[model samples]
Target: MTMFLTIAVIVLIFVVIFQIAKASEYVSVLKGEEVSRKQNNKINGFLMIVFLVLGLIGVWYCNKLYYGKTLLPHGSASVEGERVDSMLWVTLAVTGIVFVLTQIILFWFAYKYQETEKRKVFFFPHSNTLELIWTIIPAVTLTVLVIIGLRNWFLFTGEPPQNAAVVEVTGKQFGWIFRYPGKDGAFGKKYFRNIDPANNVLGLIWEDELSHDDIVTEQTLYLVKGRPVKLIIGSRDVIHDVGLSHFRLKMDAVPGIPTTMWFTPKYTTKEMKEITGNPNFVYEISCDQMCGNGHYSMKGVIEVVEQAEYDLYMAKQKPNYLDVFPDKDPAAAKADTTKTVAAKTADTAAKAAAKL
Candidate 1:
């Protein structure tokens, strides 16, 4: 019954469209003969003026209505982000001026030169001077913009500071994993065959001494305010992207390949909330790529705190799995050996009694 209703609605729509077309044809047949040259000129001129006014008003209000809400948040949260924002504003200003000026000229020409019986139309086809002026101006403008863009790109992508905090962001089917280098400030090697879904999701090689000190978490990336952070990003299953919108940082997390992005957080989470006048505001890390069915749920929070707070948070995290098991420490190893010997002796006695 539902499918039949749907088909009926579609057919009815086509019938209505056909009737509208027939009505338009009849209207054209009657009015087309009544349009005079003077009437055409007057109508075209009026429409040109109306369009010019409406277009400018629309452009003005569009920016006023959506600038802060959708174009960009009022300000940037990082030093590089500020630079990026500035470049964007510069580009917008340049293009906006050209757009408004060209639009006004086009409409003015249409209104001024609308078909009129008394006016003689100018027949000159082209001017080398005018052509050269237009061509040179755009070429020069583009060259300047490109130069500025490349300079800023290099500045932002240059080598990170020595004190930059290193974090590894791993992307998988529908979530992100954050790994922080522990006391040694180095990441352990990873092996694909060693990937344990429950314990070692990153396939970190447990035998590597560095793996013992690595801190891994599935949620809440923690950072220190006013410190540079270097992110090493990778993907396990498919391509994903790490987008830190507030910081204006983005990089692809490609499968079987590693990528990196770096930025400094100028505002702590608390400070940003106060700045934005929203108490619940927090920095977010989102997947910008469409990787799978659950891609929309692939998001994480970034908590920026003071340096002391960051240090305290790191100190409380548990060590890697290998450190707590297998008794790697000498004292713990001896105790484990003793326990094993006692258990073996007890098992032997129990077996002999059962045989008797």
Candidate 2:
């Protein structure tokens, strides 16, 4: 529906441009009223033929070289996507009806009295009935649409089903970190300095007491079909947005607080593959916020895998993946920082002393 609308708008733009060009040409060539009017009418028939051929050639070449026969990736699993699909179909139907009616009325008005000698314009002004009809119709239609949209919005935000699983996701300047509570099913405290690169603790580390059994999985998100999943989101360094195009869901993941979004997959992995023409489908999760330089690459993949596969993957992940690093003495850590600064200052002083 959106594609059709885009094409229609493009064609309309081109038509207006052609008309403007023809009007300009006619004005330039006009010498007398009779000659100018005849000249203007002739422009449409011949000009359309010439331009149509040129346009067809350009379109064919563009399609061959650039577009091919590709379908867009629609990867949303949220209710908002379904609402948009419904809105698209209704909008197309109404727009088509309006377009046909408007063109018919315009052409009929123009063709009914073309000749200046034979046609006499009639003026019938100030009809309250006509004004009332046009005003009332549009007001009622707009009101109805608004009401329906509000109703849908209410339902969309109502509540997630009882069995929905909650997953916490945090965003940084150029990466996404997701936390799935281990056996306890709750998130543990996290600190940045405790992160150990060698141990694959890819960022959810904390300095305070950390739970030994808190397993934090890092890779990609995997979910089961027909299940509701709630994502609690936030940012660590800066504000970021979590956007999933196919599901029609986007929410800001602001720092210091959590935001939430929910989705349920209507199709299983096998079904989505058949529908989308891609067997190994992964929803591209993107950051909509201009967080930093690496924002462009800050994307994560989500796969709606089979229940069996999900079970196996979960089983393989160790329960103690988020184990806290050994406790560091605060005094020792501060002493190290002070010692480093002192060493640099002493080296600078030695160089000055030698120069003196």
Candidate 3:
């Protein structure tokens, strides 16, 4: 019913417009074409100035209204992200100046040069000097912007610092998988065919001892504040993007191809919550690209903490390997051995009492 009403209203609007147009045509015929054209031109020139004023107001109003809601208010969560923020500001400034100047000139010229009986139209055929100025200025400005962007890009994707911690990120149908290299600081080999939904989420080769301690997790990725983190990203099924808007960095997670980027986190989740004045605030990871139907649901969280807190968290995490092969877990084996020894001692003591 709502849709029908909307359609009816739209149809009524068209009919009204048509009638107004026909009435205008009759009036134009009565007033003569030359006089009507001049009047319409005057109206359009006045409307242009009004539009320019309103548009400028709207731009300012929108920025004022939504600026606080945007990530820009709190600044970046990563040190490297500060550069991204800087670049963005520079780009916006350059483009914004150009936009305002162009708009002002365009509308002001239309209003000032409106058709007048006392004045004649100046035929601006071509000015090579003007053309060169416009072309060269934009080209030079764009080239400089591109160079700055490229330099930042290279630094982001380049080799991380020696002390940087590395983590593997894998994207699947509607979720993210994170892996932390155990004490060995290496990741095990993985085969696509070995992917098991139940136990082996990352398809790590058990034969590869290096993989035995690689920690695998799904919902939350952990990092240390003030420490650089290097991410090795990939996809299991289709293309996905790892968007860290808070950190102001993103990288593509392509199937069969691993991409990498690094950044040093400046604040922890606890710190951000305080900074933003939102007690429930958490750093979020969003899939920037449309992967599939569940792409909207594909989200991950990052928990940044101090080194000691991170160490404690890591200590509590049992590797995916141990989960798959519990018998091989030294902790489990030790417990089993202790239980067997206790049972044996109890049985021996009982036997001695029975003999007595």
Candidate 4:
């Protein structure tokens, strides 16, 4: 209701303004002072110049304000980030130069060619030289830009090194799941039907021996600095983008299809914090696509540490449940169950005796 009322008020305001303009024109006709087309053109030309200067100033001030606030974060932290930044600057410079030149010429022509009684207009229907100049210039510029862009793209998407660290990232409705290949250096096979919401969210086939040693985490991703890391990304539900802003990396996480990205972190978390001068600074992985209502909350943290530190961190993580229980051996599974039951029984019995 409030929206409807606001829209109605705006419509009424426009109607009132239109009526006032018509009435003013009627009053001018009554005064017998004819409207002069040349005078109107001159006024419009002057206003165009004023608007052009003001617009340029406004753009400059806005840019200054944005940079002053430090709204844009620093450059990338990955080895390939410098090349990406260079390409971006090149594109921006080309576009910026064209934008400024076109705007200047546009407003200057408007002011110079304003209608006047004493000045006669000359019309040139066509100029082949002018046409060729505009076309060839843009064509050459675009070709050069495209070549640079394609080269960068190929470099960015090159195959990962053989010694690269392998990590799997999965996106869902409102969260991310990361899995690391444990001691086996192999990711186990996964099946959609085997997915258990509580126990095995990633649906690893417990029967496969390779699945036993995978380490899974919900919101934290760990990496080794100076080591090439290959990320295999997928989504369980809708499409999502795995965005690592600091690395200048983004790839779509599509359901039923896996995508890969590779990068090497040049800076560790501690070093980056000191460089940024923000004690709480940490690298983050965020979902760039607007997938659903809870999309805004889909975020994760990345910790880049030394290789030794990463080894220590991995050593403390518990293996998957299936690793502790071999499905092929019923006796061993039973023995484990018996031990748990016996421990619980003893605890209960002790509690009863204490009450007595």
Total clashes for model 4: 0
Q: Candidate 3: TM-score?
A: 0.96
Error of 3 at 189 (Å): 0.8
- True-structure lDDT of candidate 4: 0.87
Q: Which ten residues in a row have the lowest lDDT in candidate 2?
A: 320-329
Each candidate's clash count: 0, 7, 0, 0
Can you give the TM-score per candidate against the true fold?
Answer: 0.82, 0.63, 0.96, 0.83
- Model 3, span 1-356: residue lDDT tens: 99999999999999999999899889889999888889889999999999999999999999999999999999999999999999999999999999999999999999999889999877889999999999999999999999999999999999999999999999998999999999999999999989999999878898998998999999799999999999999999999999999999999999999999999999999999999999999999999999999999999999999999999999999999989889888999999999999999999999999999
- lDDT of residue 13 for candidate 3: 100
- lDDT value, residue 270 of candidate 1: 95
- Colliding residue pairs in candidate 2: 75-246, 76-246, 76-247, 77-247, 190-206, 191-205, 191-206
**lDDT for position 332 in model 3:** 91
Off by over 4 Å in 1: 1-38, 71-73, 322-356
Residue 2 in candidate 4, Cα distance off native in Å: 11
Q: Which digits, one per residue and each the tens of the lDDT, describe model 4 over residues 1-356? A: 99999999999999999998787677667665455445556778999899899999998999887974451366779987777777778888999999999998999899988876678989899999999999999999999989987886776667888899999999988999999997889999999887777888888887877887888888999999999999999987899999988898888999889998899899999999988888999899999999999999999999999999999999877666544455744556799999999999999999999999
Q: Model 4, poorest ten-residue lDDT window?
A: 31-40
TM-score of model 1 vs. true structure: 0.82
Q: Name the better of 2 and 4 by lDDT.
A: 4
Clashes of 2: 7
Better of 1 and 3 by lDDT: 3
TM-score winner, 1 or 4: 4
The list of candidate 2 runs beyond 4 A from truth reads: 1-34, 41-83, 103-115, 124-126, 189-219, 237-239, 288-296, 318-356
